[model samples]
Target chain A: MDRLLNIDRRIIFIFVLLGVAIPLLIDIHLPIKPTPTVRAVYDEIERVSIEDPDRPVLVSFSYGASTMPEMEPMTRSILHHLFSRGRKVVGICLWPEAVGLAQPIMDELAAEFGMKYGTDYAFLGYKPGAQAVVLNLGQSMAGTFPFDTAGTPVGDLPILAKVQNLKDFSFVFDFAAGDSMEFWWIPYGQEKHRFPFAGGCTAVMAPDLYPFLQSRQLVGLLGGLAGAAEYEALIGVSGSATSGMEPQSVTHVIIILFILLGNTVYFTTRRRGGKA
Target chain B: MTRDSYVFVGFLALFALVNTILVANGALSLDWDGLGVIVAAGCTLALYSFLYKDNPLFKFAEHVYVGVAAAYVFGITWYNSLYGEIIVSYFDIGEKGANGGGHNPWVLLFPTLLGLLMLTRFSRKFSWLSRISFAFVVGVGAGLTIPRYLSSFLLGQLEPSLAPLTLSWAGLNLFLVLVGVITVLIYFFFSVEHTGVVGHASRLGIWFLMVSFGASFGYTIMARLSLLIGRISFLMDDWLHLM
Candidate 1:
């Protein structure tokens, strides 16, 4: 009972490592239920695909390489879904590290769909001031990101020819690891530009965003890899998140069981009138 | 040289030699970016080594990551933002403009001056000039934030919280949300005495807050575990070809 009180953290780490690694080595597919929150994101994109396929979907890559594990799958899957559906994509990164991680993904996915770079998809690249860029975007895209990641001027790119501001686009999806959504996009971009806003954040940030979701300010939320997995399901494409879901589910169940066992052991020892 | 230092240098030399040989042989397969796989595997293993204890390898990997990030950012700032946006646009060297007409060099002069003023912070005497630029930033930020904050956080949230609660399941959920909001607000209200029902509500508020905290903690665990899983997958799939 006392050992359960303060088990060595390394032991837990080893367990977690095995918990994650075993599922990767062996193939396992887990059932997933796409909640209404994830459905909203899919439905919004589907709506655009049906109504106006050429409308450039604005994707703010607000995450960095450090969060690539959670964010990369979401980024790749969403791009796959959008490009496969014949929706034009425009991307920007607030986090500088996102450049190295996201650009290659956009390239691979676009190539898979036989999408042209300057015409079908564009990477606006990294910007310095986040909120300032968001505010400036509400006014003008060319003014905010004058040059795409390739250093070709916006005027030279055909994808951004009709994209002058936020309103010209169809949907807003912010793949964020930080407060880019709360402080910048939610306040300035969505409020002023009036685009349907959706977000994919690290799981930790998801619980804090309930207020925004409840207020209907955010049309949908992708909470984490779980969210990414759900999005993959909605698109009917099994990507990295889907492959990784079983391990994640197993790891979570292990942690929950540990908690319950620990609690139970402590109480049972106390009931026996012994030190725990 | 010390024996330990000799061992360390020999280890590194051997590792580099093997990596190059493997890459040359295309053992990792050129399609996987063989050189990249070796380097990534080395860095990933080096980083994971710190879980056992701090070592020179982990420090080397950490520094390499930071250096690469810094160099990447500097290149982007020069090419994408500053040079492409400013120098080319101001001098009519680049084609992008908000309205398609070329930008006036005169229009950029004041902004260019203010930007230069911000650089004066490094000098002893001229640092006072940087205050003006800082003040301008702070003043504009304050002005813009007031209305946005009022409209988004205050008015927007308040309106939704005040929605009428009915008897349906949806309504019951809304009712629970409203009660949680009110009780939480009451818990923070220090103006009134909290001896009886107010204390009870405050305790309930604490329970609700605890539940929220617990949910956040659970999510945090999931987030961290996912990062671990991601790295392991990279190692197994991309580097070692174990998957």
Candidate 2:
């Protein structure tokens, strides 16, 4: 018991490493059920695809490489669903670092679906100013981003020919690692235009946006890799998020066990009249 | 050379040998994409070295990351914002004629001046000039944000809680929300003494706050673990091809 209480933190780190690594080496194929929030997002996107197929969907990649693990999967899963349903996608990035990240993923998925650029999709890339950019986009997307990431004129893109502004989009989803979703998009773009909006964010940032979810300011939210896994399951595609679930679940269980052990030790020590 | 330098040299030699073997074994190609993967994996491992102990490899990787991030930001800012919005828009640098697309060339002067004024903060004597820029920014920001915030965050969130009550599960959830909101508000109300009902409500508020915090903390753990899972997946699938 004393040894357990005084175990080296490095040993615990090893446990966590093994927890993640071993599961990746051996697939667990854990079942993932879509949460209500994530389901809402899926349903909304489905509705948009069915009812307003002509209107382009706005997909904002508001995260960078650091958060790619959690966010990229969600973006991929969403894009898969959209492209498979023959929906047009317009990608934008609020974060400058995210500019490079969006194009590759969008291009790869577009290729998989045999979707042509400028017709099936367009990427506007990043522009400075968070709130100002959102407001400008509300007014005019082509004006804000005159040229797409590839230096092609937005006017030439067949997908965006009829799109004038934010209101033109049938659905908008922001996969954010930062405050761009709640801080900029919700207040500036969604509230004013009253378009259907959903969000995907780092799990840590998820709790902060629950109020927005409750208010229906956001239609649905995908929080972290778990949310991504749920989205992938709903789409019936076993992407990286699905593969990552095993490792993630194993690591979480290890962490919970450690937490329980630590608390039990501390309480027992306190009851024994010893310093915890 | 120092001991750490010797270790680094040894590590580099070992890495080269491993790479050669990988190439010879047809595990990796001598292409740009393959080279990129190797470099990325190297950097990831070097950064993760810190978990064992802070070493020169970790520092080197950390410094490289910071430098790359700073350079990327600088380059993006120059090309995207400063160059595109200012120079291109004003001087008609691109294919679009005077004033580029549709922006009023004269209307941009005020913002350009404000931006230039912001640079005055670098000068000790001229620092006061930056205040004009700051003042305008603050004024404009406040005017734009306050009403939007009131309408969206405050009223929008408040409306759901004030929805008509019923005897269903959703109504029970709404009731809990109402209780949570009122009690939490009472907890922060310092004007009233915690005598009887207020004390109980305040105590309940503390519970609600703790539960919320606990959920947040749990999500935080999940988030961190997900990142670890991601890194491990990269190493296995991309680098080692073990998956």
Q: What is the lDDT of every predicted structure here?
A: 0.85, 0.88
For model 2, what TM-score does chain A reach?
0.97
lDDT of candidate 2 over B1-243, digit per residue (tens): 987778778877887887787778877788998898789889998998788678988999999999999999988777666775567668776665233353567877999999999999999999999999999989989999998999998889889989999999999999999999999999999999987999999999989999999999999998888888888888777877778
lDDT of 2 by residue, A1-276 (tens): 577788888999999999999988886787899999999999998999889989999998888888888998998899999999999999988898888787898999999999999999988778888888999999998778877765566877899889899999999999899998899999999989999999899998999999988888899999999999999999998988898889888888898899999999989988898886
For candidate 2 chain A, which ten residues in a row score worst on lDDT? A146-155
The residue ranges of model 1 lying beyond 4 angstroms of the native Cα positions read A1-7, A268-276, B1-27, B30-32, B94-103
What is candidate 1's lDDT per residue for A74-160, written digit by digit as tens? Answer: 998789999999888999989888887889999999999999999999998987888888998999787788778766777778888
Q: By DockQ thresholds, what CAPRI class is model 2?
A: medium
- Positional deviation of A94 in candidate 1, in angstroms? 1.6
DockQ of each: 0.58, 0.66
Candidate 2: regions farther than 4 A off? A1-3, B1-14, B97-102
Chain A TM-scores for all candidates read: 0.95, 0.97
lDDT of 1 by residue, B47-163 (tens): 886775677988999999999988988987776667756676676763554334334567677777888899999999999999988998888888989888888888879888889
